[model samples]
Target: MKNSTCLLQPSLATTVALPVIYSFLFPAGSIGNILAAWIFSRQALTKRTQYIYLVNLVSANLLICSTMPFLTVYFARGYQWTYNSVPCGIVNYLGTLIMHVNMYVTIMILSSIALSQYATLKKNSDAQYSQAGNENCQRFLLKKFRQPKFAKYLCIIIWLTVLCVTVIAITRNARARTMEESPRCYNIRVEAGELGAMVLATGCFFLSFMMVLLSYYSLTRHLSEIQRNTCIEEKHLIYRTVKRNIFVIQMILTVCFLPYHIFRPIFYVMLTNNDCPRLNYLVEIKNFLTCLAAAKSSLDPVITLLLDKTFKKSLCGLFTRSTSEQHKRNPDIFIEESPDT
Candidate 1:
């Protein structure tokens, strides 16, 4: 029964699902990420930090997406790995590296944004507290807290650390491949160096999660302190901002990514152990959730468009002008409604 179970693992099902997943994602994710990259690239210098992180995110997404075609073809060929050993090593290495980088960059960006919000709130709170003491004190504190220099340095350090780890993982994976006669191509031997590589990747994942959680906790704590002592209006605004930001971040991590991570280890264990039929259902669900998580990258631009007032206004104005032009060209067919009504 154990042998049967091992043999029955859903390798074929996974292969069959690959192209379908790729088809769904390529148009929506690949295209959307590219458009976002283009839009962010054109923004002014003041928009550099957020936009630069976004560009990195988009670039990583593109790199990941670019591999889908190769993957689709590989899987469509029945997971036979006909692309030769070098291409196989390169593809697997690049794909995994990009995936890790994307995950880390996203976490870093969110932490940076959260830290920015926290700093802003802290400065404002300090200024108000100072004003309560004396107007001159408030002005002096405001000048002193005009910028948070450490935030930029912190972001750069996070990026560099993640980049170094990703490069190391890719180099290790590439170096570890060996040809297998049955598979007809080079593959990482799970019992050998691949195990170490997997451990490193898992460590990186946990570290990223830990950093994000800590940053989130700190931000929340600072906000709570500010809220406790501030004026009613300022307190309300700060609370709302903090609540919204926390909700968005939590939704992104828990709703989108947590399920995949939670199930990944379980799936790995099931594959290593004799594959239980029950595990197959869990694996299917995990794959679906992973696809949903990947979709989040594609949906991020849309989320910004909906949530950001400035972006919403720009989109609305563009659409309104286009509609008005259409109405002018065909007055009898398209009638405008009066705002008074």
Candidate 2:
């Protein structure tokens, strides 16, 4: 076992950029999630089971957002904190725990949404093809994914599985690395199990990523065939909505998640080998990418707005009310004075 000191100091970018990035993420993510929660509150979950997944996604995002201020302070203070301090441990552990939960939970929920949307599209296609009202066996299995009870159970399973795995991994890793503590909170050493866990998580992420890609491709193909065969505007619109939802899910994974998972294994390798000089720079880069992943929480509300009709209605109504109030306060501004006649 290599008894490495905490040689991973923050670079100028890590110190400056992390705090700034997380400072922005905090308020943005908080407001977005709060709005999503409020909007979701008004709707019945049983009527729209996909909202179950979205609500869970928003919950995960909110959990991570709550940790942002502590993280921002930790990074801003040049990554310096007494290793044995209670506060330091709480911040470090919660930050790590919530971040991993957010990443993996987001991955699972979005994958579920994509798969559900694809299943819905296929159901529509089957009807269009006049399959004598016969349900394909595979479609029947996926159809369960769209049901309220199944979605609820699935969300519960996802939360429990992710939380248990993350907690176990963090605890074991911390126990293995706690000898001769470094004065920095983020200076964690990689153990063999941690590396294995990282690789496993990365593999899962890629698998989900590929699933989203396949769903998108399948949707596009179906949409094209439908457009060519029939000019039914309603079918076209339905296909478009499903396609856009899948596309947005793909974009979120690509922008927020791809970089971090891509770099994580390489970072673990470097950290384990103790390439002291280069490892410092790599840590900084890894942290920035991690921030990007966390920023997806801030982006989840936008996803909710796009994907949920009820949420969109609520948001639009809120905006309309705010505008009405503004106009009420100043009627002359809206009247425009007839453009000076």
Candidate 3:
């Protein structure tokens, strides 16, 4: 059983080949998240609830990536079981917990942001649509979540549910371990009979994916309406930035995250159905997909800044503060000041 479970551990070759996948990601994720946090600290971002979610999402990614060093050790050490499994289990558990929070919070934040943008665009589209009863619904959502109390309670609920799911996953993995494998560090080895949990995850993933798509669709529709009804080309710079950000969000969900989500149900279902469950090739594919999943932690900050113009501009300001400050000084001060004195 120990050896069989070790089969779930990635081979030395795979780990070696993918060192950058772990090592490079950790620093990039850490720096990106830290910068995002700094950007959020600006007073301008304080008003919106989506900024709160964005900060927490960045935090979750940071926490998840912090465990990469442990994973790096495991991978770099020829995939051998060396350290105490307790810490390994801990890192493993945290990795999953943060991953879950990151995914759902991203869906929640980005979709709401897009929806808010849609509402804004709709309000400016035409007098007819802006005055309609349907506009009230949009306006209500925009304001409802803007309230700190409402957004705070909702965020607490989300974190609590995430904690519950993580505990369950850790408990399940713990209960399945035999004496031999109980004390060894290894890769994520899922066996049969995690379908209920997987189903829940699958449901959440699909629902979030659909919501994101719907929000983007509504946003684009309103944007088009605004263009037709107003001078879009004149204000196209503003719209263009938002559109680019939305495009990056779509790409992240589709390119980085889609495969793992799409394959998760099928992988578990197949494992449950097969009596032996000895598909080496499938395990390799799972590792590859999981690497892509791991990349999300690094990519998320990039996504956040890519999507948020204000945050990007704020971050840029921090780096060039001295230059900006110099520009603020009187240009004449540098022109023969000694002669004037």
Candidate 4:
């Protein structure tokens, strides 16, 4: 409910520090996202609903990551619009646009993964697990809405929703925070009574989070019930995979998105110069925190590589290519000559 942005004097630290941070981040993010795009482009991703969403998620991240170099230079120039207005506005618009798109798409994708696991459970379980009447209704709803047949449409809808929501952040003709002194490309403002907007954004984040939480809560309760009814020695393979994916999703939110979402409004205040001089020490921390969310674009590929064996196989080939080819050419090199040579 706090004011999102309020006008104040600019700080020297943010001006200097952000460029330094982005200078390091831009190339890394660009390369990582590009590589991810290549990995996801392989024909295998289309078969799995989860990986399909991941592919889109990676594309969204790449969209944002590709823009960082421009922003690095933009911030490096102390908010000056060395570039003209239209390109700046489009870049400014896309900056917020793709970032939030990535967040929402991530939420949707994780939710689908959780629900799909539940559906899988429903398919394999017996009457004891399905005895609850309301539970039947819930499953009916999940079956109706979260069907695999509609996943592509659902992902498209999520993308459109993100664009519709963030388009409001784009200003006309000028850059994001266009002022006489600081003609910058950041979409910050000092509006009164618009605490509702910030609240809505935060609420959407937690709302998506709560949906994910509820899915896991249901999954946990169902899992516990199954564990009790089934034999102790029966390994719950699906349960383990579902649980692990859910955990990884939560970890992604915690490490990559949570800090930025938590500190965003505060950074707006800082960026707008409302508490500029007093909070100058937070400058470096703020720089790192803000970029941390975008850094997930790169980290997501790492996540894909970890969670997906297919991606791991593909990614490993890039590193082991020459050695593998060499071994293929000379089969005796890999042979163990009694370990004595």
Leading candidate by lDDT: 2
- CA deviation > 4 Å runs, candidate 3: 1-9, 76-79, 82-84, 96-101, 123-139, 142-149, 178-193, 229-235, 272-278, 322-341
- Residues 229-271, model 4: lDDT tens digits: 7763454765676667767777777777677667766754555
**lDDT of model 1, residue 266:** 60
Candidate 4 regions exceeding 4 Å error are 1-13, 80-91, 94-97, 126-130, 144-146, 171-197, 232-234, 265-275, 279-287, 317-341
- Give all TM-scores, in the order shown: 0.69, 0.85, 0.76, 0.74
Tens-digit lDDT string for candidate 2 (230-313): 776855666777788889889999998999888888777776666667777777788788888888888888867666655666
**C-alpha displacement of 229 in model 3, angstroms?**
4.3
Provide the overall lDDT of each model, using Cα atoms, as 2-decimal numbers: 0.52, 0.72, 0.58, 0.57
Residue-level lDDT tens digits of model 3 in 1-341:
22343334455445685565788888998898888887677534344555655666676677667767765655555345532455555545554444554565555555554544444444444433443345666666655544545555666777788777767776766666533353345433432225676677667767766766766777677677766766667656655555555566666677766897787766665553333335444555665676786788788776666565565556667876634344334221101111100
lDDT of 4: 0.57
Q: What's the lDDT for residue 257 in model 3?
A: 68
lDDT score for residue 297 of model 3: 72
Instruction: Using lDDT as the measure, name the better of candidate 1 and candidate 4.
Output: 4
Query: Each candidate's root-mean-square deviation in Å?
Result: 9.5, 8.8, 8.6, 9.0
The count of backbone overlaps in candidate 4 is: 0
1 versus 4: better TM-score goes to: 4
Q: List the residue pairs that clash in candidate 4.
A: none
Query: At residue 150, what lDDT does model 4 achieve?
Result: 58
